[model samples]
Target: MEELGISLSFSRPRVSNDNAFAESIFSSIFSVREWVDQFIAWYNTEHRHSGIKYVTPNQRHFGLADDICEIRRSTYEEAKRKHPKRWSRHIKSWQQPEIVKINHPRPIKSVEA
Candidate 1:
């Protein structure tokens, strides 16, 4: 690798959750180029990512995240109310986050006297 001026760094073993979704997409039936295009389309327009409150990335991009989240919240609330015993706690949060962080850095605390 060094001879080709390339460096390879591997993430820790058994810690591949971050790459699981990509792996699943790439392992689909489509060919490489076709899969890339298809994956992009699906990811942006169709796929509802849990990390983003189950809305498509395009929805968030177009500023429709809040509206969609509200709808989801209402749906869940109604369902829970209709079947109260089906839920043991409050309805799941469908709130759209103002910011999304990947591998977010930990904040450092300041020491006071």
Candidate 2:
């Protein structure tokens, strides 16, 4: 590690991009670790992930995501109602699934009789 100048950092689960970005910023291993820590904190608490209906991971973890999504859904519905011409189609869904998986399984096509 010392000869090659390689630094090891533990980043957030399922987030590969953070490790490389932090590593490229500084040469010091401690710097990488520190930055990764800060990034993880901010990512979980402040970042609104679209995967989770634009709610922070902390909000989803604490069971506040449902209410937040409900508010968004209501607001969007109201806006569409007032301005029908603005949107040509349906509004985006704020509904969060029971399991937030990166790869959802393809629905099996049944053979119709």
Candidate 3:
């Protein structure tokens, strides 16, 4: 970033809080196991970046901030609902042992093998 004149600053390596904002954005984008390029395109055009004061990165770069907050909120909620089981497991596994032990149904052994 410094190379592009976006002066870089960070805390000690082991402490991630200093870069929490960037980390959160990355996690949101990369957590899905589907088309990453589509996600990137959507993230660039739609996701509201909180570090940029709830304005989308695209909006901030283009000076266009309208109902980005609502759009982002709705989109995030839609994504969560679209993958309820995965999202629920992600949020609950750390706190619920039964949830963690819910084994995914295994595929049958191949007869040819």
TM-score of 2: 0.63
Question: What residue pairs clash in candidate 3, if any at all?
Answer: none
Q: What is the TM-score of each candidate against the true structure?
A: 0.58, 0.63, 0.27
lDDT for each residue of candidate 2 in 13-93, tens digit (9 for 90 to 100): 445576676566665778879999999999999999988999999999999999999999999999999999999999989
What are the C-alpha RMSDs, in order, of all predicted structures?
Answer: 14.9, 12.8, 21.3
Per-residue CA lDDT of candidate 1, range 38-98, in tens?
Answer: 8899989999989899888899999999998899899999999899999999988988888
lDDT: which is higher, 1 or 2? 2
After superposition on all CA atoms, how large is the RMSD of candidate 2? Answer: 12.8
Q: After superposition, how far is residue 51 of candidate 3 from its true place, in Å?
A: 0.3
Best by TM-score: 2
What is the Cα-based lDDT of residue 69 in candidate 1? 89
lDDT of 1 at 89: 92
Tens-digit per-residue lDDT, 1-113, candidate 3: 54577544556544537888888888887766457877887887888654454555677566454454456556666777888765743321111111212256778988884
Candidate 2 ranges beyond 4 A from true positions: 1-27, 102-113
The candidate maximizing lDDT is 2
